[model samples]
Target: MEQRPGKREERKVTESGHRRTAVAESGSPATGARIAGLGAYRPQTVVSNEQAAADAGVAPEWIAQRVGIHERRRATGSETVVGMAVEAAREALDAAGKDANDVDVVILATCSLPTAMPNGAARVAAGLGCRAAAGFDLNAACAGFNHALAVADGLVRSAVARNVLVVGAERMTDWVSAHDRDTGPIFADGAAAALVVPAIRPGIFPVAWGGDGERADLIRIRADTGRMEMAGREVFAWAVTALTPVIRAACERAGFEPGELKGFVPHQANLRIVKALGAAVGAAGSVTATDVTHTGNTCGASVPLALHALRQRGELTAGDPVLLLGFGAGLSYAAQVVLSP
Candidate 1:
């Protein structure tokens, strides 16, 4: 007898030395998965370049010229990472036309949680009323959102979950010193989310991801001071020189060229890096996100938040192909092309 396309049978020897035929179960009916909705939450408190400059011992003009940031949002005491994630998740659920009951899993992507005791995803799931949804956290630093997005795509397509809520939230202010010129003005606080669901056609494409553990020391939080440290010049050099191939690989995986992209949403790290990467990829015709100008680098939340900004501005339409790239701390990077929801 012939087997079904997705089913397989294998003969294996058991521990007792008995040969048994094992059947591999088929996955969900989904051919692929796509992001059904996207939502973002920017903290209410806005920090201007003047304020950041005062703390970093630099002039406002210097910041603008160096990083291309005029202002950024800073989360207050009430805006915990879990709380912001919940807010963003609720908005994403609403946008997806789904309720808490529809979610089977919740993945929170973040790196700024104060402690590792109780994970943030559980609280996020509880806050969103997803009582039965399994929850966990994924930490890839700034590349976290893109990483979680790829995982969500797999979960949905493989029948592991019918719907996955992927949230990227951060309170970078908690980890970076306000007085550190390297990290202070660049990092900010925000949250964004995406609802992944089964689709007849793939909306989320393959991811080009990698890490450089050898360069982990380029960006890290010091244990002694409990503050974040960064080798800005080194990081910038690595990003521009190394990530162009990643961008191209992602586009090729999606069956498109960089020039064919309608939008380019890289992590909102800085204006210079964003532009250099964009140019190297030859995506000049794309509507590249410059969200860093206002949002700063919200770490994991940067990519999704930038995507939301483009949607809000009506720069992206349904079915438009956009390349999303995220790279940062941990020396991690991931890129993929996703159709605008």
Candidate 2:
């Protein structure tokens, strides 16, 4: 018998005089990584501005003028965060022509879980039937998806994972007070996912991420009340001004000018901030996503949900250069460029 080159083999004779052999296996690292597919799931129950405003003691027009959200999804009793993630992931895997066995890792990005114990990622993996896939949760508030995406890119390029499933799922209603006008109308529930795979040419570019701990108090979950609190005016100001530079840096790192972008998908924080940031970055020619108008702000799930909406509308074409930005509580922010899938 002959041994193959570049491979090591060990041979030993057993006490019974039988021959035994062992060989070490290795995987070749990928040159880059790309999003192979995308999917999203929004709850069936719709909360109209009129309904939301009645609880907050405001008029429907006020909700529309303030957040530009006429309606948003509210998860039902059966729509758990992990359950929504599984549905989104299944659609993504199908779109990528993959199955549960194809997933090497599952990253669930969220900040609004019912409880801290038994992370949602593991449950999501189990629901998807990805029995052997590595699973974990990542929290960067609304920026969670972008942060998870960066991690997935590294895993694929480093040969740590052949296919990485990144899902952003949130049940914001669980953390927000329906009677609190400031947080109620602006937050919603939904989930979205992206499947990343090894690629010969990079599709997911470098991420430009940073956090402002100094402004962490701007948005938070009040320890005493166990509800979300936000300085709407302050967050809006910071997003329009501070996030412009981050978006530019991401495009620069990807070797693309703002004018070259085909689409811009910022966190569906609010319609005002999304439009302001898109214009400030000079992505005039790009189709800007206004998913917030219908989906409101889903926190961690916003970015991927917005992207999926664009794809469904036929506003994004395959291989088109799209810039994604996510920012929220923790005063955290992240931006990146990815070719449309």
lDDT of 1 by residue, 1-341 (tens): 21222444243546663334322245335677888899889999999999999999999999999999999999999999999999999999999888986777899999999889699998998999875677899999999999999999988777666679999999999999888888899999999999987777899999999999899999999999999999999999999998989999999999998788999999989999999988888976799999999999999999999999999899999889999999999899999999999
lDDT by residue (1-341, candidate 2, tens digit) is 21222234343446653334321235356778899889899999999998999989999999998889999999999999999999999999999888986787899999999888798998998999875677899999999999999999999887667789999999999999999999998899999999998777889999999999999999999899899999999999999998888988999999999999999999999888988888887977899999999998999999999999999999999999999999999999999999999
Q: What is the lDDT of candidate 2?
A: 0.90
Per TM-score, the best of the predicted structures is: 2
Number of backbone collisions per candidate: 0, 0
202 Cα displacement, candidate 1 (Å): 0.2
User: Model 2: clashing residue pairs?
Assistant: none
lDDT of 1: 0.90
